[model samples]
Target chain A: MRDAFHDELNALNDRLMQMTNLVRSAISRATTALLDADLQLAESVISQDAEVNRLYAEIETSIYELMATQQPVAVDLRTAITALRMGADLERMGDLAEHVAKIARMRHPVSAIPVEVRDTIVEMGQIAERLVTKTGSCIATRDVDLAKELEDDDDAMDRLHRRLFRVLLSKDWPHGIEPAVDITLIGRYYERYADHAVRVARDVVYLVTGSREFDDSAS
Target chain B: MRDAFHDELNALNDRLMQMTNLVRSAISRATTALLDADLQLAESVISQDAEVNRLYAEIETSIYELMATQQPVAVDLRTAITALRMGADLERMGDLAEHVAKIARMRHPVSAIPVEVRDTIVEMGQIAERLVTKTGSCIATRDVDLAKELEDDDDAMDRLHRRLFRVLLSKDWPHGIEPAVDITLIGRYYERYADHAVRVARDVVYLVTGSREFDDSAS
Candidate 1:
């Protein structure tokens, strides 16, 4: 029974890592689609999110079954619970990627990102990809140090998010209200995507340490 | 043992209801702050979010203790898991409300909402309040029917969210990029809040029936 429960936990970890990979690819493609107005890439991101959701649904079912059958306690219990949360955050990361793709699709034949903000969007996308990559590593390795590093990536994403806004709110922002609205929502999507990645990493930390990061700080 | 587990579940439900009320008030005051440019009200919303967070942290601790010590199975298990998920959604709702309040605070003495889009925001805020109110009741009563009704409120919120974008995109929109950006984000915050409420409702349904709504649809 113990070995079987451990196997189930390993399977849950593998599923969560798969989710991270999919979300990473989704955001990477979403950024390209936005920058180049590649409707095909955008469409692919939007459509392929179903696979991410399918994985998430599978993870949910498996976790429920594992808890129902195994009744894991202590560290194993934390593993199951945090896996559920990590799956949720990764699932949301997928949605955020799709949201970015939808914006690209919406403005097909014309790039949604203004030329001035192009570099920032590129950087945000890279940060998002980087964060998710590290998140996957943390999940797979249970490396607490790597999980802590995710906060730095998150901070960098926030900096770029603010920069995107500054460009929008600049006096010479020539794109007017339409692009402003698009950029505002797009920037928010990337920032939120980064946030979910960080959250998943935090769960990894919690699962490994058996202590929530915030609680550690408070104590 | 079963009676004690159920007692803990009941306490979790009561905490969730309390969270719902806190978030509902937060959104209500956030809307009023944005519309009236009421600095005091926005400040209150911003500051009071800590209380919501406190309650959520308490609930998390309780749920973790419940799961760890009891290893509840079946319906008791679902209730504990869903309580954690619902607590998370409600905590996010609190953050969304605080986002609105921060916008209000930023634009103090000058309304962040333009006169043209004011009605839509008012309606959005009202729907948010109503959805969360139903969410509270759904958690309290585990009423699947009441939980289903939240989808209608969510639809109403979606309609208003689009209406907000329409007014912003219209050719005659007098506001420039700043207010437009604010409105776009505020609209999204409210829309996402409603989505979270619907999710909580869905969780309520799942806890009651031991079946996911989407699973039922798929079958």
Candidate 2:
């Protein structure tokens, strides 16, 4: 019985890592779709988010069942519960990626980058990919040190997010309100994506330390 | 043992309701601060968010303790875990309110909202409050009917959200890019607040029904 419970726990860990990989691909494709105006890639990201959601649904069901039947306690209990949160965070990351894709779809054949802020979007996208990739490693390995380092990546994302605003708010901005609005929303999506990744990393820390260190005003 | 576990559950329920009320007020004051450029109200909302966070922490601690010691099963287990999720949703609603308040503070002595979109914001704020109030009731009463009704309010919020975009994108929009960005983010904060409120209600539904109805593309 104990072996079966540990096996279920290991299975849960595998599924979460799989989800991390999916969302990683998601943000990666989403950024490309936005920068290149690739409708097909955007469509792929948008439609494939259901796969991420389906994985989360399975994780939740497994956790619920594990708790109901096996009644895991202590470290095993913490691991099971934290997986549920990490899954939700990853699921939200998927949604944020899809949101970026929808923006790409909305501006199809007409890139939303606007050149002045294109580099910032590119860097933000890269940082988002890096953060989620590390987050997956942290979850699978339970590396608290790796999890702690996500804040630095998050800080980089924040810098780009602010730079995005600076570019938009500049007097020389000639894209008018439409692109500014698109960029604002887009910038928010990337920043939120980064935050959720950090949150998943944070959950890994919580799983290890049994304490949740909530960030101050992630928005 | 079961009775003590249930007593703990009841305490958790009360704390969640209290959190809902705090977030309800947070959104209310945040809206007033944004509309009226009342820095004091905005500051109040901003500072008081810590209270919401503290409450969430306490609830989390209690839930973790209950789970470790009690090992609740079946419905009792479901109630304990669901409380954790509902607490998280309410905590996020508090943060969303603070984001709105920060926007107000950033534009202090100068309203972030323009005259044209002012009414829309007012209505959005009112609906945010209504959604949260009903969310609190849903937590307390477990009334699935009231839980279902939050969808209509959410739909109304989504409609107003679209209306906001229309006004921002309108050719007659005179506010330029800065206010448009502010309005875009503020609209998103309200929309997300409504979404989170709906999620809490959905958790209530899940509590009673044991199945999660994942919404399609809330953003």
Candidate 3:
């Protein structure tokens, strides 16, 4: 029974890694879709979110089942509960990706991002992608130090987010309200995507350390 | 043992109700702060969010303890896990409210919502308050029908959100980019607050019906 439970735990970890990959792809493609004005890629990213959600549900159900059946205690119980929260975080990251894709699809044939701020959005996307990739490894290894490192990585994204705001609020921002709003939301999407990845890493940290000091505000 | 577990579950429910009240008050007061330019009220709302987070952490820890010790199955297991998710939803709702308050405080001595769109924001806040109130009750009673009704309440919010966008996009938007951006984010805070309320209510629906049909994209 112990071995079986360990097997199930391993399976849960594998599924979480799969989810991380899916979310990374979604954000990467969605960024391309937003930058290139590629409707086909946007549509694909939007459609693929269902798969992410499916995996989320699978992981969630499995976590609950593991808890109910195995009654894991101590570190094992923490691991199970953290997986549940991480699944939700990953699922939300996927939704943020979808929102980005929807924005791309909404402005088809025309990029959602203005050329002036395109570079910042591109960099934000790259940072988001890198953060999620690091988060996947952190979860896989249960490395608390790596998990803590994600917070610093998230700082870069937050800095970029603030810079986007500065550009928007600047007098030279030639983009009118429409594009400004779009860019504002798009920047938010990337910023929040990184936030969620950081959140997942934080949960991994809590799972390892049994501490809540790293909890960021809320969700 | 079973009775003790049920008692713990009831306590969890009570805590969740308390969280809903805190979140509702936060949004309501934050709206007033935004509309009235009430810096004191905004500060109060922002500071009080710590209490909401405290309750969230308390409830979360309790749920994990219950699950690990009791190892509830079937409906019991579902109830525990759902409570955990609902706690997160409520906590996030509080954070959204706090964000609104911070915005109000940041622009203090001046209202965040311009006079042109003030009424719309006021209505959105009212809808958010009503939705959370109903959500609290639905959670208390596990009323699936009432839970379904929240989606409609959220629809009203969505419509208002879109209307705000139309006004922003309209040729008659006299407010410049700063106020436009402020209004946009404020609208989103309320809209997302409502979305979390709907999510909690939907979780109640799922708890009672054992259905995942109403999973709203992601948490």
User: TM-score, each model?
Assistant: 0.97, 0.98, 0.97
By lDDT, is 2 or 3 better? 2
Which residue ranges in model 2 land beyond 4 Å of their true spot? A213-217, B213-217
List residue ranges in candidate 3 displaced over 4 A.
none
Evaluated at residue B25, the lDDT of candidate 3 is 94
Tell how far residue A107 is off in model 2, in angstroms: 0.6
Q: Of the candidates shown, which would achieve the greatest DockQ relative to the real structure?
A: 2
- lDDT score, candidate 2, position B82: 90
I-RMSD for candidate 2: 0.9
Q: What lDDT would candidate 2 get against the real structure? A: 0.93
Model 3 collision count: 0
Ranking by TM-score: 2, 1, 3
For candidate 2, write residues B107-188 as lDDT tens digits. 9999999999999999999999999999999988999999999999999999999999999999999989999999999999
Better of 2 and 3 by TM-score: 2
Residue by residue across B1-219, what tens digits does model 1's lDDT show? 878988988888888999999999999999999999999999999999998889988998898899999999888888898899999999999999999999999999999988899999999999999999999998888899998888889889988999999999999999899999999999999999998889988998898888785432110
